[model samples]
Target: MMEADILIENCSEIHTLKGPDRPRRGDEMQDTSKIKNGALAVKGESILAVGSDKEIKRDVEAEKIIDASGKTVIPGFVDPHTHLIYSGSREDELAMKIQGKTYMEILEEGGGILRTVRATRKASKQRLLEESKARMDRMLAHGTTTAEAKSGYGLDKKNEIKCLEVIDELDKSHDLDLIPTYLGAHSLPPEFERSEDYIDYCIEDVLPEIADKDLAEYCDVFCEKGVFDVEESRRLLKKAKQFGLKARVHADEIENIGCSKMAAELDAISAEHLVKTDEEDIIMMAESGTIGILLPGTPFMLMEEKYAPARQMIENGMAIALATDLNPNCWTESMQMVITLACLQMKMTPSEALTAATFNSARALDRPDIGSLEKGKKADFLVLDIPNIDHLPYRFGVNLVEKVYKRGEKV
Candidate 1:
């Protein structure tokens, strides 16, 4: 018999997210690939096996066994696009937002990404790590085991490098597996007159430094109306690609500006915040097989009436994922919260949202190991208090995670 460290039996259901090990699209997103009366075995940091409760109990001898009773088990969430290394809060912007001031209007009034940028620039590396660790703690408590953390709040070379360094520290020390992204071109620094000049500075100075130091796995830019336009985004992403970093784009959060199309042409791994992306943008992205990471929390927090055309994207055969967009403006630690917004605002069903939150989000990060609970995959998963999948999204605004297990150990 196979020996195992732990065996969890009699789960009401288990969504293994069985996959061909790639992002799911169209009707594929609707398949949870679940097992009824399921059970799973964990041996060290990997899943040894998963099957019917009878099958697991018959085939394996485990040191510990837990009866999950009526709970639902699924892979821990993988948040692919989050500004996770910044220091500071933007609670003051709440009043401005409620006053009918737009996100761009708040920025023009010196409040938004740039506002956090200034604070992040001044924070010590230790302080950043401490603050970020707290956030990671909350993320883990809410069932996120792996996440992509971007260093965009520090817009300059030095401060940007500092933020990446802190991300590195947290990756090693914290339970969360952080994939670092250098988003130096997130905004135009005040020192430069033109956005083009700031982009040049980033490509010339910041890009090379980040690449040489091997600080980040991907490069991201805010590609929108008021930020880096298509051409500017193209220049930096191309250079970052040359420097061995993969591409991710914050495109069409407010306006299209052809950013999603540009991202598809460059074969960006994912284009995020597509609230304004139209059919052409959707078609091109689908053709390129670029994943659209829908951050529903963004529009929800921005108080905008429009959200990403998630149903259209899914219907058009584009792979869609969901994330918290965890930043100063939309400060949320729970992927559960993100899933709720995705289902309610973007019109994705709970099953599709769960798949987007787990497997598709992992594929977006290009990590194949953690999303599904397949045999030999990392044992990062959650045991939720809910009995079935519907309860996950149906019960919102509260933590549904009853237990979180990362790499086979409960946290």
Candidate 2:
């Protein structure tokens, strides 16, 4: 018998999400590559074998075996966009939003992102690390093995580096794999006279330090109206590229001002929050191989009526991904809830939502090894109490993840 580290046998169902190595698009997104009575053998951190129960039992032996007889198995969720390393909650803003104050109006009154920045700046690294660690635990409990965490609340050079340092520490300390992103351009800092000046400071001061320390894999900008415009965003992203960091953008969330088009032009890995993206830009993004990362939970939490045009984007051959946008503003670490919001509010199918949350989300982060449950991929998966995949988004408002595994070890 071929020995392995762990064997999960007699699974009721497995949504392998095994298909092309690239992200799914158009008709391809419907294919979930499901297997019945499946079994998986893991060796160290990578999948050794995946097949029917009888086939795996005949082919392999394991040091430890798990009988998932009545459980469903799937690749661990990948959250490509999040601001999870922050100081405090924004519940006060929630009350204002509930009372019919618009997002921009609140921002003008200094009660949105800036409020969180104030708290985060005042917080010590140890406190930030503890809070971020707690959030990472919540993400793990929700079945997310890999998540992208951004540093933006620390808008200045010192505090921005401090936030990224905390994120790096959390990455080393937590079980969840945290992908760090430098989002110093998340907003115009209060000290800056103009948004351009803030963008210049990030490029001139922060980007060099981030590159020197190798703190982040990606550099992101909030390319929205009353924020960094498309031209300024391009300049910052271009400078970040020179430092060997990939580009990602918060594109077209509040207004359709061609941020999606700009993302395509920059060949960014992903464009997020395309709530107002036009059809031309949609086609452009699809053609440019840029993934569209949609955060339905943001709109849901804001009580906004217009969700992203996910159906249209999928129909137009765009590779779509879903994330919680987990922040003090959205306040959710549950990708399961994001799936539900994608289906019920964004009108995505269960299969599409699952694919978006898993495979496509990994692709958004440019991670090829962690999204699927194939033979060569990392053995990060979830055992669910449900019978089938549809039950996850169907039975919302509850945690269905029975257990989580990372690198072949149960966490």
Question: Relative to the unseen true structure, what is the C-alpha lDDT of residue 106 in candidate 2, on a scale of 0 to 100?
Answer: 88
Q: Give the TM-score of each candidate.
A: 0.98, 0.98
Candidate 2 accuracy as TM-score: 0.98
Evaluate all candidate structures by whole-model CA lDDT and list the values in order.
0.93, 0.93
The total of clashing pairs for model 2 equals: 0
Give the residue spans of candidate 2 off by over 4 A: none
| lDDT score, candidate 1, position 377 | 97
Clashes of each: 0, 0
317-375 in candidate 1: lDDT tens per residue?
99999999999888999999999888888889999999999999999999999899999
Question: Every model's Cα RMSD, please?
Answer: 1.0, 1.1
